[model samples]
Target: MKRMVSASAAAVSMLLAGTTHAAVVPDYQLNSSWYSNAQNAISARSTSLSADSKAKNIIVFVGDGMGISTQTAARILQGQSQANNQGGEENYLSFEHFPHSGLAKTYNTNQQTPDSAGTMTAMMSGAKTKAGVIGVSDNVNRGDCDVSSERLVSALELAASQHKATGIISTARITHATPAATYAHVSERNWEASVPEECVGKVSDIAYQLIHQAADIDVIMGGGRRNFLPEEVTDPEGSTGRRSDGNNLIEDWQNFHRTGQYVWDSEGFNAIDTSSTSKVLGLFNSSHMEYEADRDDADEPSLSAMTEKAIDILLNDTHQQQQQGFFLMVESGRIDHAHHGGNAARALQDTIEYSNAVQAAIDKLDAAGELDDTLIIVTADHSHVFTMAGYPKRGNPILGLVVGVGSEQPSLAGDNKPYTTLGYANGPGAAASFDAGVRTDLSALDTKQLDFQQQALIPSGSETHAGEDVAVFARGPQAYLIQGAIEQNVIFHAINQAADLGGNAYVAEE
Candidate 1:
């Protein structure tokens, strides 16, 4: 009898412990006062509101290659430079205004200088992998059938499983690397145009899977219409020089269209009825949409305009009460393109446009009283090699040569010293020649020199990406999780923890 009683007591204790663990809430605490206030606001709401508010909506804004220096350069070019004598500082971008901010280290397992495919795969799936790998683990050999269940699930996929609406907006082709990381899986990132033969009958192409498999992605904007259309029907210029499946995908989409609405240009996009629509497909260019600076009024919709339209249509679902919300991913993808091409003017313009989109989202959410309940995260996937130096007069134009150092300085004697405005650490276009005619003044030169001089090395004229930590800014609940330096994949865990979402889908168990 004594032995039986002891066994019963042990069982009872185990039951009690299990019950207690089940009742415990996940850890979603904030480390900063600002985030604490936001958390208080979230908890104080009525039970019904709070219940629906458990991350009902998530909006992630990715500045493709716009790192800290990119933001500073954009601000300077926009006349909001910190050097300006204006008394009041320039207003923060919508994302910048977020109360919590953190930094993320971007590097792939295989490469120091990472590509968008690997970085975004980590961002979307929470798993770190090699440079060219996407949607799957680097541990899995490229074409091996015996790949591990180590596959990571995207936040969008998780939200879809919970009956939430999901949307992907970008300035690049819908099938581009960053956006594709959210839905498609493959060993290679360039597989956008190539659909596996096995996937043909079993699963649609990645593009089709994104539109069909999940919760009928409500809003699909940006370019890559050619990928959807068959070769015969494709516009000459729209063919991305890549072919897939030998079938026009655009026709397939149209045939599969149920309540879907399609818009090819800005005019058609503007004509859509956001209040009554549930599904929208707007592909403005045959490839990626034109850059914001180069896009004609008739051809493409502005990033801000597209963002507003997406929000309007997403909110149309009767299911999204103040408590139940949606999930949106907006990408300012062209900044990376501009940097790759080494066009400073074009890159800065796109950055400004991206900032405008952030402001637009803030205005819409604030007006609807949803800002406090919503968590806004803004960050870049990686850093670029761009740098600014060259001290000119107090009011000198940022584009001009540096005033106080280098052989280009006017005040410096022959072969003495001068200065330049721009610099790069590893760029092919660093300054190597000491041209006397391009000299400037060098009176107040700083002791430390710039990262690189103009026309110094390879002369390719384009800056490259650096292996450095990039900044992450946040506002709303759990903003404090973004403090100090952290690995890039930590972002996924921080966001999941703050939203009270469970599971370590990406991390390996010790």
Candidate 2:
């Protein structure tokens, strides 16, 4: 969605006159970590709590379900894949060298182990909400229809309100919880295309909200084209639309922006010249995009390509309009899906690609000499239950069997069975017969295969999220605020302070 050229006068009014409405987030939530940690971040840097905003642009990279263990394993995989044949432990992901890093407590207001909707809401809106909701306060119940009063403004909304360019990129459905949190305020995350009959007109679906409410967004690229098209229509990929309301939100998106371009494949994506394109909507798949290892480059653009193009388009907007810099959120969304399937190979591969996307942004900004003026934050919304266990050699293949140092043979447990270095606490990969006290033998199985499910301790239909702290790394203006252990919601405050969005930075009383 893009702000209309005809509304330029109103846009300027809103930017100079302040927001037309106040965010409905509770005062208690606002005064919580969002205020304290922001003050603490400035204090730690020996700067004024209400210091002048420094960052002209902000880019947030989210590696969905990329935990500490996943990061370590992926680092090794990336290093070992290099031509130098070096030991993998010494290598670091691109964002690891970001200068400032911290741990975030990833818990929802209702659940100990968080869901993406809540975690992303906390990061984008500066408030921790209930697990299944997006861009709303904790007061609303899951699936509730009466949520207009519970709306919480996100960092993207703040940037849009200030007449700044904004964009969202995800490997998952654009309507998925994490990306949806940037703009949609739904009481239930499942309301992607149409809500239940009772909530039909009262609550607009997430895709509809993206087209109507958050229409000011400058860039939108991801899967879930089915959610936007009429059920009678079939996409170029031969997938039928899923919307039951007969409303084609994709058409509405194009109609909303005079210069908007909607693309469905790599050809159309590559054809766009960012210098002249004011807005773009790219939906490459009907559902979630393919994992990096399984993706066809001709059908879908790589995450790094999307990142580069998004930066270029947003950068062009700022220069063309003489507006403040842009705000972009990019997510490697399929990392979580691969982990859920108990496929560590695809998970680690997606994580590596996520790192490449981060590097792409760094390189793009560095080339344009805007790296220092941009605030880049790379973090995960929450972690998976994935784990890396056993004592393996430094040069061991991260996806191979666990072989002890100086031992070529795989390590065997008391039951005399071999296991891989990577596994899950619970998933489809559980031992063949746990009740019979039998563990599957991995001696003949190739654990490095993309379809190979790692051995798990408990049998579960799907892996669950873990209730542990996730890491946050940052660089450039106000990056110092990311240090130390802080509540997850503090992320929004740091961004707000960096860009002075909403003009709501807390000022210490002298």
Candidate 3:
């Protein structure tokens, strides 16, 4: 009986020891096997390419809805034709010249093609989530999600926690989906400018949460001044929109007068002393700033200008010297809106503008000797259903109709045609008729076509999101981590690992 009792005690002790050991060690070991395989494959492709040390600053450029096809289409429209005989020029979108390039699958759990909220949330937090969801997971209660411990820390928050200065610049409203995902938490992505009646008098709006919760927002630029102002402030159209709160949020921002500077126009933005100002709030337009093509002034800063200004201010912080680095997120968010409106001209122009912003970052960082120290990553949150198909003549206008050649073209049964101008799966301006024989003037068509055989899917109107993978171009430290196909959330992890931001607490261990 004594020997049996001793045996039982030994078993219990062993079991407890095993449980303690498991608790001490992380269950999910760092699986370098995949990384090692990728490294080997990379070595086989190029001997010159090698990973660099840790980056000092990280600049992420997200072209809101600029998918891979969008990039390809933009390249072609920007004079890089994809023809065999014609001399096609290679016009790099600044970051494309980077030593590393990769593809990222942009899909949320709920949808194959995700909205900016879910996609950006993944990029910012390094966690997969449902479509239309922003910041927090679907499991968390909506109102408490932001302050919940289960909520994942954003890359911006992580950088701030490490003492780095952070900034978010966008061409859309500062409270728009992409930018909002980085700082604000809500059940829906569209909650940025939204004010629920339940919390109207008691709690702050998402816009307020964005500015107030952000511990180190050195630069805040873009539109959505309507949300910031009281009902009294006349909008750009000279009318007062709905205001849930009697308190003017813009005035609230100004109350922090000594610590911040607010600019209402381009001239004001340029006049501000970035050297002296630690915090800047620039609202150039009442809503989204004018389209890049529509802008008249050469002196007026574009999205690129705002990005440069943000970087300048963030890097100037003297306190937390060790955290002297800056993490800036710049977004060309209007691309998606333009696509939704079925404005090819506007969409492509926005793409070019986005590329220009990327170029500006490259030039500024290069000039400041920060290019090598900065990990500049350029990508899109998701893609639109925008496509370019049909065999047009070499150097043909991308905005023009698709013409088919005789003999080589597919047979058209009784006036049924084989070519189309442009198409969408389901958008507002989709091709109205299925019969190609109905020769509608291509010049009058709103959206472009994908050129698939049989019936072409039309978009509801101007916009549609694509479920395709987006391109990621990277430069500087650990850029190699961005090679090959990867999940959208992996981008945050790669950035975190490259910057040594530490573990992803959101990812559960198997």
Candidate 4:
């Protein structure tokens, strides 16, 4: 057999040229053994993976900025959180065992690394748009709202037209880029509450579109209360509303859907009678919801709780004569925010919570006997610079210092100091600019703390989104589409093809 070198091993060789044993680094761990393991995994998938002939309900779980490295670290953390730290590497975060998965190239029409608006628009609208734009084609200039003719239709709109009951659940503001891409059309993603002074009257902000552009939502739950209320109405959080139009959209929502119930806290969210209520509207926090680690101080529901409620409500409609199944998007949105601050602990914790939410949805569907009838797709809008590096043994603590094979103590880096197992490429963790280059000594710090920020190579104002591809895991109808490297826009097409939402449903202009 040819002596084929894995790219990972090749990189290691290039980095350690002229050093003895450069030809082989046991710690690098990309040898024939790795090849065999990967091949075996693929063979297993071929035998066990099968898509449902039809999917009556579609659930898309978005873990924003959750790259492959993030997933690995989070999976290990989730496993370690268990009693006695049993089988960390083998611990499957809900979607790890998903039958079908593929890498999605997340580039936008104009940029290599994309913003949430463009990446999510690609997922929701079957067309890759420009960075900073949402639910509109590349023809529209950012911040210019007069592109009504260039506005792109979205998967949620197609679901609405198909008579499917739908829901949106997120840890982000309801009007944030990810959720807004599902329904709203705007040249700029930041137009969540108020349009630009120049674009006013010509364009509707994201919050406005959530109500006016898409009136058929069966469940709407997230934060961003400011965007829905009048300035005079102070929320329980002591913040004023952001709506400049003076419209109390919450009141409008109540009046418009007289049968729907509006709630702002966990108690109210928990009290909703999914069996009796025609619709549900929940706004947990004044802005973005608290991170899962900080949720103990408030009555805001967890991602899992909200997911169950949405699934139950969407399922309740299936008993109605007009029900055409459902489409639900659940986002573990806070992961992106945590990564922005270079807080690896919070980011991984959010990933775990997001996994719990996905498990909750699967459990709910299974209990309702809708498992086979529903399609669940777990993916990220794009990747962050999150990485798990250093040569840690299989059972070493994911958050602790890396321990090389056969070594009981943490290994020292080239700087002769211990480094963390997880780190960022560039973030607040970087002590100085890239030109200066500062490395922190993490040997004495508690890297497992929820507030801990991992080390980075380049000091940035904030960590940046990565240009690398993200993974998409799928089950149920049309899951076969997610078998190899794919364009991000294929997500919308796969769902549309499976649900029969009519071809080319995302074409801009009516």
Candidate 5:
């Protein structure tokens, strides 16, 4: 079959032949297998890639622990949710139909199986780091206090430094690893509220870093209200703050921007005038926000709502006056938390919510005429131990028990017990009540219940992350660079190249 050479590879070849291109990506990264192998794979797959183009605005959507299996299950669940729908397997999540798609090998420098801190760092900073560190290189120890020289610059910071608007939103605490990597640099991801007394003077905690260092961030939203408020102050929702430092970072945030609004509830969020708001900070929950399946009375904005509002606030900023564009990162963080609890129902629901957020960004940007110039990337930091099996007949409920293709009743195992269509490799669910060495019979239970935990093979407190490649989907501007199997860090390079962010693969502004 005839294959077209990738526009990026062709451009690189011609540029190399003509002039010496300046490279800002580290020499170690340029020499590593992760980087070189990704380049080769993209070049070999260029035949299916799109023409090279530069993007003015960039939006990245991260579905935490959303492995390929989770995506497939979520797509089917969504399809089945619609009226008069066929089997869910025929459905596609919003980003799945992007023109370019590939797999990203998600691993930290120290471990084969990755964690959010390391994986997100790779995507935001163009370099991989240790599993427990955020926005810093692997050269430093996991909990080391001093990281001045080891800190890495993220795409958001680079964009903001160039006078472009930047924003971050998540369903988890904003100080959590995934969202934190976009702005805060810390040796330990847990230093959200405060650090050890011995290390206090040497390094600031994540929340403190956000308020003091990343002052230019235009829109900030998600949970972790406790991290920002003082211990003596209780939020309107009755949750007490956790900050030992007695620092009201929310007040500090307001002091930084005279026109910025700090909102903690749905009423405040809905009242914000995105058209005139210079900046906004929203902390809907004291911890991570409620899972989508349980968010009805939570008084918090949905992931889709947060995403749409963040885009609007960024678009309205006059500081982005030069047309330098903006960079926004949206994370569906609770998907990982739900998977860790072995609850596939909640996980799938949150994944669907995440897909809606992606669609929301696309719709909003397209309506604003920014879609064509915006490079939107949808991907996951890593995979969970979740699995889907059984040859169930078509039109079966995704959350239902495993009923075989030809049977009217649930399928039985060799041990004479019924099972669900979804299960985990290892998790708390593995300890399901046992009766005389036989597994618990799930036939009498409602497997589709929101609180139901899927059965697992090995007993564990929580399901672990899988050491496999996750899917990456892209559309608009330099998206062709996403083709073929690539390293996770390649995401940062793609964004840099597409936006001319002065990286090794940087494309000169036309």
Candidate 6:
């Protein structure tokens, strides 16, 4: 069921953007109905709007490459799916209803349109860094280990230090940029399994850091199974592991957490008892996990399933009473990958799935009556160059061609060719790739297919990141800090404050 909450709902009036004086309604019309409502909304949140004394739990959802347009498109696509729907603009994703939201400047120190490694580092470590660095200061070079001595501690590390349970979940490889930022510190995001020979002894690989440097990951679930196993170890899929190192990190991780269970498939994942089990490590794929649209091959758990399991395990059944709170990061990592591949359908599908995962977490929190104490922050690491253009009529299918208001045919371009409503500014879909002089008419094509790639302007093998600010949506305790146009590092501050990790808690550790 759609849990509809009025944007003007009390306690959330101006919490998201933290703007109370009316961003839309201008001019001082004190006698107008709009003015009266605005006043009431501001008055509504005046009672208790301070940061939480201490948050019992914290969950951050990063929909990689989910820009403003991606979010808007997904919201409409999801809305249009329902039998009872208006123009679709009225439709809201589960997390969109979050009382607190703000814009985050996603650029890194070195690049305008940031990479996941740097952007996620800002959010997870409370420090802005260069484009390709992970969990380290911006002073280090991309591949140089000589300056890798200084590492910025992450919120998860701090949470772990405070004796709180910590976990990371993703649709991509667990050792990928987003999740790795929560734990690993390395010069390059690509150094997953095989560290370069020159830096082998000096710099540890990401997968190596996951088992060694990371805080006690109570509920680690994602792909990147090959990165942990040795080269001789054959994965369940018959693919050999990538580690040149003789060590099998999987068994080592299991041994590190004596009671922890290592799982590599759906059967093992689903059968585990999160209540009695304090730790879980599951890698479902050899590398990146399958997209939601293409998961028929195996009995893989959906993002929602993984989210629920992580939440359950972190909560520790309350009876165990071993951990006070938890910090979890859930990433829809393939949204960015699909965009880079120029597949709009896959990206939007993954965004919807990310929304579903957020909803699942919300449901779990509500069921446990922890909504008041658990802070939920949903944002993105960066954005893609994908765009939604060619204005179509209201309620038009988001993935369909741009149809004129009264005409049955789609709008024609300068070359007399029809275009799709969704497309990339520059990507593999660009017409230049086929022929510089010809434009393919998309009218007859199955643009709505799951594998469909939106047409682009330039011919690039992969789409590039867009240099624009992404959105941050928050709910629960201390979410008010999420308001206003802010830098990406502010996210770490908000979460750190909410969880009472102490101001700049990790600085002392460094």
Clashing pairs in 6: 16-100, 16-101
Candidate 6: tens digits of C-alpha lDDT, residues 182-206: 9887889999997788986787899
Query: Model 5, 394-436: lDDT tens per residue?
Result: 8788899888887899988888888888999999998883555
Per-residue CA lDDT of model 2 for 323-425, tens digit only, reads 6888999999999999888899999999999999999999999997889899999999999999988999888999999999889899998889888889899
**Predicted candidate 3, C-alpha RMSD:** 9.2
The TM-score between candidate 2 and the true structure equals 0.92
Clashing pairs counted in every model: 31, 0, 19, 0, 2, 2
Collision pairs in model 2: none
What is each predicted model's overall lDDT from 0 to 1? 0.63, 0.84, 0.66, 0.79, 0.84, 0.80
What is the TM-score of each predicted model, taking all chains together?
Answer: 0.77, 0.92, 0.80, 0.87, 0.91, 0.88
- Predicted candidate 1 versus true structure: per-residue lDDT over 1-510, tens digit per residue: 111101133432432232211111111212222223323333333222323234546788888998787787676655544454442124355567677787887988788878887888777665677786666666655543322233444566555545567688999988887887776655665556655665444334556545444335668888877766655564634455345556655555566776678888888898998877777888778888888878887778988898888888877743364224677889989888777655555677798899889889888887777777667788888878777764454434444455653334343335566544544554444333324445333445432222223433234556677778788887766666666676676666555545654332222234
> Candidate 3 at 185: error in angstroms?
1.0
- Cα error, residue 220 of model 2, in Å, equals 0.3
Overall local distance difference test of candidate 3: 0.66
If both were scored by lDDT, which would come out higher, candidate 2 or candidate 3?
A: 2
lDDT of model 5, residue 181: 97
Question: Model 2 RMSD to the real structure?
Answer: 5.1
Which candidate model has the greater TM-score, 1 or 4?
A: 4
Give the CA lDDT, 0 to 100, for residue 58 in model 5: 94
lDDT of 1 at 208: 54
Ordered by TM-score, highest first, the candidates read: 2, 5, 6, 4, 3, 1
What is residue 449's positional error in candidate 5, in angstroms? Answer: 0.9
The full ranking of all candidates by lDDT, starting with the best, is 2, 5, 6, 4, 3, 1
Better of 2 and 5 by TM-score: 2
Model 3's TM-score against the true structure: 0.80
RMSD in Å for all candidates:
9.8, 5.1, 9.2, 14.0, 6.3, 11.5
Task: Name the top TM-score candidate.
Answer: 2
